[model samples]
Target: MNAPKLRWVLFTAAVTFLIAVLLTSFFKEIRKVDTLAATLDKRMEELVGEERKTQKLKQDISYYSTPEGISRLATEQFNLVRSGDRIYKIEVTSQDNLQ
Candidate 1:
């Protein structure tokens, strides 16, 4: 073959190899970016769930700081009642007790 023709063939082969290598590298980088994006989406969902829990806790804290909420907690937890409230009690006996 002529010298010029041989040089041209060599240059074309080199360029093709270089392009193949670059495309492979770029495909790997694209896959890594996609994986990172999926991970970020999952982490964002977890953050949103935690934020909701924090908001609920804040609401509970604010309610418990009020007089009405305090009164309800005292009544339910301690069975204590305010003045001017009436109390009633009932007793039941089973058939076995009579026997």
Candidate 2:
């Protein structure tokens, strides 16, 4: 083969090898970015759930501050009776009997 032709072939082969190496590294970087995006998505969903829970707790706090809610809590927690109200007491022998 002529010297010029041999040099051209060698140059083409070297360029092809360089391109292949660059493409391999590029694809590896893309895979890493995809994994990071998936992890970020999971964390974003968790944050959304926590925000919803926080909003629900805030609403409950607002409700519990109302007079009706306070009265209900008092009756349930302290077994409070209104004026002239009769209270009934039941005796149970065993847990199964109560059920």
Per-candidate Cα lDDT values, in order, are: 0.94, 0.92
lDDT of 1: 0.94
lDDT of 1 by residue, 3-85 (tens): 67888999999999999999999999999999999999999999999999999999989998999989988988998999998
TM-scores of the models, in the given order? 0.72, 0.71
lDDT of 2 by residue, 60-81 (tens): 8898899977877878899996
The runs of at least 3 residues in candidate 2 whose Cα sits more than 4 Å from the true structure, single-residue gaps closed, are: 1-4, 81-99
Q: Please name the candidate that would achieve the greatest TM-score relative to the true structure.
A: 1
